[model samples]
Target: MGINDDASAGQAPHADALAAGNVLNALPPGYRLQEYSLDGVLGYGGFGITYLATDHNLKCNLAIKEYLPSDQAVRDGTFSLRPKSPGAAEIFHWGLSRFIEEARALATFNHPHIVRVLRFFESNNTAYMVMELIGGQPFGEWVKRKRPLSEADLLAVVRPILDGLAMIHASGFVHRDIKPGNIHMRTDTDPCLLDFGAARKLVSGKGGELTAIVTPGYAALEQYHSHGHQGPWTDLYSLAAVMYGVITGQRPIEAPARARNDPLPKAVAVGDRAIYSEVLLRAIDWGLAPAEEERPRSVQAFLQALPRADLMQPSSLPPATVRADSHSGFGTLDTALTTQLEAALARHLGPMASVLVRRHSKEHTTLGPLRAALANDIESETSRRTFLERTEGLLRGESPSRPPTTVPGSRAPVSRPPTAPPTTVPPMFDPQFLAAVEAELANHLGPLAAVLVRKSAAKARDRAELFLLLSDHIANTDQRRAFIRKSVAAFKDKG
Candidate 1:
């Protein structure tokens, strides 16, 4: 019997309501597949359509993934699945069986972060994998709706995902595709790794053995070549790309283009290193290294390179190792030196000033470089003098007056009423003001700076409004004031 001409297809009287001319070729809502009723199309991709479904016997919601490779098949006016060309049938069935095998393999997994497959079956000349209908936002949309994830938040989300990847790797499979869209964030912020359609048996140096599918920006260069040695490092690159996207709000350039002429900037160089730990940024850069051997060989090693929990605690805690070589000309400093430097800088800059100072020390090992970097993040001349004096004292082995009790991004109790929003609207015609805003924003946010400045400028009614909107981008109070001071000067110079 032709797959589409099955008796089950004819019995679903209300199936047409859901399937009514949907281009994805998904069975309409109310269409029965075994004991489950399709509710609607939850999502569709190049390889399949995920349908929100109800298991009538169990009376529970599920997501059903129907394998329909778009390039090789089409649904005609009669809603029948057919190969685009007669010659494609042999290849189609081979892929169809592989899809079924993928479902079977995933059905054995029970990890929290890995999407669970309940069962697999054949229908409509294709395969379907039934999964629990997970409730959460995709990582792509999560990043859009929420604020940029700090290094701690990023690690919290990705660590569990790496745990899940470890299981898949142990099962002797490579999840060839891992990207923002394939990751879902639960309401409580736990992450689930989704999509295994690109997964293949862990085989190396074999051409045409694995499916040639990849998400461009997230795919490693090896995945591009059929004979490329695919291994754990393949997923490692994509996972790092996903984390890179979370912090920077943009994917690294595609691996192919990068192989030819890599214009990709190191994560530390992309933005203010203070906003994110140098360790986290460098780890991401290492994960995204073009060559597979250069990338982290294992998930555990990658996770180890990230900032630890202790680093995110109150500033009074012992200093966590911060790599200073790339960010500042100085090599890595011992924890004591770091603590002393932070303590001295905090004295002059503010409670949160240590973050900015530490970041400055990374990019500027010498006093001159340190002063230049600090000049952009510090505003008052007196404060600047105090900073210099404190540095001089620290260099001379003087003790820090007192350590900051609070972390840079931590909130303090609100004892006083919030300040009123500025009412005086400034003219919108100042180019210098906008340029200054972008420049300051780029210091922390990297390439996303221009995009954010434009977004803030659009909502701004006046110069005061613009300042208020952009100020939130800078996490450190000292840096915010410095940005405002410089931007205000731009308007004055124009006058």
Candidate 2:
């Protein structure tokens, strides 16, 4: 849409008009503000009015953000900016100085995905920031026009934004407010990060007053408290929230509410697993964690958590062969031994293991063929070994030496406490031992390596079974030796 000079025509009335009127204090058409001429209003944000203007000298369109804190200031009939009350003038000028500082700081950077500040100057007793007018709909509007985005499309838009965010963070500033509304999608599909006013306060540390401006569902929990320690991870939280919105066509539950009760469903938990990879979905969930430390510490770490496009193609999507047959209703394996095998496989394959085991059971009922198929599904030799070690005896009808005592994904000891009655106790699962296995496994397989340990540990009846399980998942002799040494240390710790 072309910019218009009419104050009421372009900007929507603010929802809280009494507190902050939605009207843009548009300068009259042809009115000159130094090198630029007023053209129309772009939009109103909590801190400023972004106006469409013509750069007279440059002969191009520009977006000028007017430092008009609607709550503290107002425009008279002649369009002169003034504080609402005598007591509010100090706060208004303070914010004005921050707005100019934001413009000056942004002018020094030149990144493709970041907004470019062209100039900044005082106009009508207020500060104005002139930026190159970006061409594209706001990301929120784009999402509405395009309901659901593909994995490729989502990554294409987000990666560049992350790259830009990384640079911003490297400069020692955080984009505390990162939401769909501030993300602009160019016609070429490049995403442009917008609105540095909120971030500017944080960067400049002006007046030591917290910005307190936040968009619910996008702001990290720590942001709610002024004194809370916020860093680069805060932006990562909002970025993940934006991804969640893109995938589900819905905003996640607000962060404050999530702390009391995390009612918001994960991207995978909400039926997005079919379209998105578990790694990507998990990364999104990980980034969205309420606690700051629980989230990815940096943009690079978050990027690493995402599966590469090439790897995602082959391993992220569940294999087509695992689908259940509608007519026979026998697509899954459920024999007690097979059940145990499926549990083991699920640690590696995520939710797909159940389907795969059942399909393999129907096609390769015999142990020999079934074992071969299972091995083919596993990517690591160590993981394959673990699978065989657990199932070999089960397939041969050998009774387990002891009852299973370990819980999947937990390292807590399964053995009874020394103070407890011995009769009620099963066996113990040593947290130290499981922790060593997970740490060693993670070096080779990333975070999911722990899954291999948890699944294997859960089925072990004794130390022998546990050793067999660990050996199966760690094929390298030196790595196996290292694990053994760590286990020995753990055993000593328990003793």
Candidate 3:
């Protein structure tokens, strides 16, 4: 879950007493769960509690979400959650199963824009989900500090989220909640879509409908009723409402009010035309339509309706003098060199490497500044240093230590010098084993796992060597050990 801003709102009478009671129910600091230690409560809501925790095995921070469902359940003297009433037990258990299902489904997604679920387990008569702890402010708070953002800046945030949501929709899920507080903005990586507690699979008829969970001013009209028709258009409405809030500094009129014939101002009319493009504003209006039928039907349709040319333009770079290298000129850099650099950087970053390269290339005609700029985006110091060393060799016109691989989205591989053939060709591992490794690695590294696994498999001589090579990509000592142990066990079972 992303950082929640207001957990205390909508509390029943005896709010203070309820808060203190809930604290007693929460896990105390230093309490251990497998490899993780509870540090403190990050936030709580009607559904569950999210705790800040340290992964003792991985030696990093993470979040643990416990299924309490405060409205229908409570912690007893033994600290195990039981239904508040005998009648509620069935509903409570049903919700618990849904929570577990959600964790399993989320674990399979390797999208950078979606919050990554690391592990899930059943415990204490309920269930728990361990997720990557995001280190950034909520998009709601970010907008508070940096309102009146340029159209380009807003698209930078919105485009990645739409891409992630599109993936979720294609996988048969709908993020029922898409408020500003649920979007996390990271300094080093792309913004992430968070708080999937309200997410549900796209099922037909009444059997598929679950209890309605909504955020006011952001939710679509269909979300107000349990049996109302909902799909991709439902989420798009909430996202457009978020955009309306970002541009006009206030959330649009809540959907129910608009459904009652109350006026909701158009985004185009409210926003400054000079600062924001009419196409973008009108697209937002189209998304904010009270009737789901009136809204853009899909993410692709919504994206097509928005301004596109500006999104492709590189973000402006800080002014710097061009370096003295003859290859450094005032115009675009050499196409071949750019391709080589993108391919090298992609090994460290993922597919986003090309976008980052293009974003910086317009201003950085010189190799030195461009490399430095790209390195800054990398979060790990070790990875950044390694990237610099590799690119430094490339910029100096030196032959790579190994053969160049193909860059994603490119038609051909980066050209390499001829070399003597090796005495032995590395044997290929079973396809099933490779897929298992990729899935396991994705638990830790998200979307980058596939790329890392493919590269490591190419160089590894055997199953053991392959696991060892892939383990290097994981920074945590205990996690690497765990990954290797699990992979070996899996390989032995297959054999």
Candidate 4:
């Protein structure tokens, strides 16, 4: 949504949220300003203010961050490191270098563990970043909530953090401060990582400025050493300390001054077996090592050390890879509809289908049995969105994922189902609609297909089932009828 949506979406976001979506939408084109009033202030940095804002567009909670010169921006004249904000308008111009550079840099990163940037813009002397709002408290708060993670859970959290870090590291950036505050996790399972405010691109060995600043407790000894340049190993060291705090319930203040040459991880002893495992301890030790050179060289190396954990279907993760291959293969499109996608795609694409397979695979792969059996029924219907504006009544009755539908003017199904005799008579299949009638039919039932389909609506009321039957009947094809019939069959089976 534009800045206006950010601002005036009925209920206000957390006072800290960026004035709901109104502010975000109000922003001039190509300009954004997100304020962190969401969930109260998480924290602020030298670069900007981060707020947890409600995203009216996505209809999900979000952390909307606005980038303006930190207090430091006023003193410094440069744009990025040692950058200055000349004045109100000047902050925009002075901060332009960092605003654009950071936006460009953030765009390159996309991972489940890594916080995703939803959108970006700059205005009113502030640059804004719209980001995903994750559950669970930050690491420090997490420590207070759960005391410390169980060793297995600790491993779960650590591996993905390293994985995310590895991605950033692969991009040639070092998370200068890998502290507990920056390392966040989801409560249940499959905890991921967060925060990259201190991330720095390691280009031309200019990261020397990072030597001046480091995350306390977690920072590697080399990070504090002005003379010693650092690398990815520095982050590994800090992450280890975070591990120490999570399992041992005590943060490691510092590493041994003279780290030993035994570069690989060694077992760390924790008094409570209930809290930790030998393998996990070893992983921590390797990460907590003093020398950046001594820690695992890459995030991949650390992931290899951790247990073989599988990434589960995220509660909100979308299957980027979509298909419509059901039992009946895609045939010629209905004169009006395209066959590019069909209900069967869900079965064919399967659960194991990697939405990003083509993106990450070295060798082109085909859908497999394991994947096929485990299907992902990712529907691309947009009915509620389209109908929500014309008649919000439709939204209350069905799900957003359901397909589009229509009201028939007559009993007979035909390409042109005779126009409405009067305003009272409803029409059938508004081809102008963007949503699919089939998808909407299922959504209208709210997954309770068995009972709802039999209960017909008042003939006057427009509904998904009515439109679906009319469309299928009018198409005058068994295949068309089978589409809805199969859905009914699936629902019955589920019951």
What value of lDDT does candidate 1 attain over all alpha carbons? Answer: 0.64
Model 2 regions more than 4 Å off: 1-24, 144-147, 201-208, 314-437, 440-495
Q: Which lDDT tens digits does candidate 3 get at residues 1-495?
A: 221333232111111213223564786677778788877776566667777778887788777878887778988777679898988898889888888997899878889988887879987899888888776666766666766677777887898999999999998889888877677778523788876766778766556566576677888889888777889999999899888888887777779999867598888788898678665777888899898887878887676566554233344222355455565332335666676676676665544455456655744777767777777766579978877777776566654344346544332324421121234664577788789889997665544467667877887655544665555545443554466546534553211
Model 3, stretches more than 4 Å misplaced?
A: 1-25, 311-495
lDDT of 1 by residue, 1-495 (tens): 111111111111123223424645667667788899877765565676767788989988777778887878877766557788877777678788878887888898999988788899987778888887666666666666666556666777887898999889888888887877667777635888776666677644455365566667888988876567788889999888877776776778889888866898888678456668665777788899899887877775665555545436454233445444443344544455555554445444433333444444534544445545555555668876666665654444455344445533211212111122334655564677688767866664444456557876887665544665555555444655666555544532221
Give per-residue CA lDDT, model 2, range 203-237, as digits (tens): 45543345555677788988886566677889999
Give the TM-scores of the predictions, in the order they appear: 0.58, 0.60, 0.60, 0.48
| Residue 352 miss distance in model 2 (angstroms) | 30
Full-model lDDT for every candidate:
0.64, 0.64, 0.70, 0.45
Which stretches of model 1 miss by more than 4 angstroms?
1-22, 76-80, 204-208, 315-495
The TM-score measured for candidate 4 stands at 0.48
State the local distance difference test value for candidate 2.
Answer: 0.64
**Total backbone clashes of candidate 1, pairs 3 or more residues apart or in separate chains:** 9
Error of 1 at 107 (Å): 0.4
Evaluated at residue 240, the lDDT of candidate 2 is 92
Task: For each of the candidates, give the backbone clash count.
Answer: 9, 9, 0, 41
Provide the lDDT at 97 for model 1: 80
Ranking by TM-score: 2, 3, 1, 4
